[model samples]
Target: MTWKSLKTVLASLVAVALAACSPTPSSGPEATVTVFAAASLTDALTEIAADYERDEGTRVRLSFGASGAVARQVEAGAPADVVILADPIWMDRLAAAGRLDEQRFDLLANSLVVIAPVDAAASQDVFEALSGGGRLAIGTPESVPAGAYARTWLQATGRWKAVQDRLVFAADVRGVRAFVARHEAALGIVYRSDVVGQDAVRIVLEPPPEEQPAIVYPAAGAADGGAEGRALLDYLRTPRAAAIFRLHGFEPVA
Candidate 1:
């Protein structure tokens, strides 16, 4: 081949190599949805997020904490697409502040239980357990829905004032469980769902229906979440997500 022909062939080979190294354009725009959720909903939401990512090809980012804390974060302008709170009061605060969209509803329900370390003597009597002269753990009522519900139960059973001096406050229900699991607190009040998969602690008592507070989890889309956020909110109410919530010991609201 002539020198000119050889140069032409080299140029073609260079073009092919560059084309091979260039990044291929994606078929669709990448989508990511952020969800701020209550601590009690952690395991269930995580599994649901994984399923959503797998089925919808949109990434789901989850942030879990006490319901009031999560609501405060949203109020402080956190970048969240969806918000799932353990109480409607927090959701109401968000709605009042215009942080949430019009799409909102009760998502799940739970029950309160008293738990103790696995090795501790199982006592179904709430008063007897507290009379043992050890600290009782519970979430902080100021910012944790679980704590508020626990307080309600205690008051309904006429034990709130009696146990005030023996209370150990935690930031969330998980923290309460951790305290009991480690034997730091002799007993703890937490949601039934928080005890799932936890071998270190066992529920000792579930407050009767009359003494139990109404526990509800409310979910909403953020005002700025737009279409992607709305889609995520809708997906959470589907049958697939409900099954996961049930598996985690939460009752999905119809």
Candidate 2:
């Protein structure tokens, strides 16, 4: 071959070798943030995750369950990046275990309500509505925040002893809603957010402001979450996310 042609061929071979040795460009999301959240925040967070992924080019992996269950999972070293819980008690446990970053805050608030099957008559009085012999469903008070709040409200209203015999305990707030929706229980106590978009059950009683228990949702980034997890935690506090939470019947914390 001619000298000029040989030189060109050698240069082309060198370029091909370099290209083959270089790392392949990724076509997937820029990063992924795994979140463990309370069951009550399911719909709102799912909507917000879509917006975050589109705007930030990152993926959000969500796992929803009872606040206590997810908190215990994080403590057991489950690979979670962020945690959003319906109660502060569980968040405190995570913080004590050193599983969370310093960036923790109360993210949202909700109210407790008594729900009944859609066919049931509306009742304004919580105690009277639950006076029937039929079962009254609630979350398991020991592990579920919603249940604990329900129990507190019942006790405060002087109805705990009256309703104790008829109580049906569920694994989570969602389970309580399901019990009422499926007619497995005559009535159920759950978060206001849990009934949003649900047609099978309707709110029969909403505790007055004076009687309502303080319901707060706290969020934090896991120590392993690094920058991406912290970013997601911040995004959840934005105005856009607040609007979404409002649509789902939750009050976003300012």
TM-score of each: 0.89, 0.89
Angstrom error at residue 228, model 1: 1.3
lDDT of every model, 2 decimals: 0.91, 0.90
Model 2's lDDT to the true fold? 0.90
Best by lDDT: 1
Between which residue pairs do clashes occur in model 1?
none
Worst 10 residues of 1 by lDDT: 123-132
* Tens-digit per-residue lDDT, 115-204, candidate 2: 999998755554565555689999998889999999999999998998999999999999999889899998899999999999999988
Per-residue lDDT of candidate 1, residues 134-249 (tens digit): 88999999999999988988887778898999999999999999999999999999999999999999988887887778999998999888788899888888999899999999
Clashing pairs in 2: none
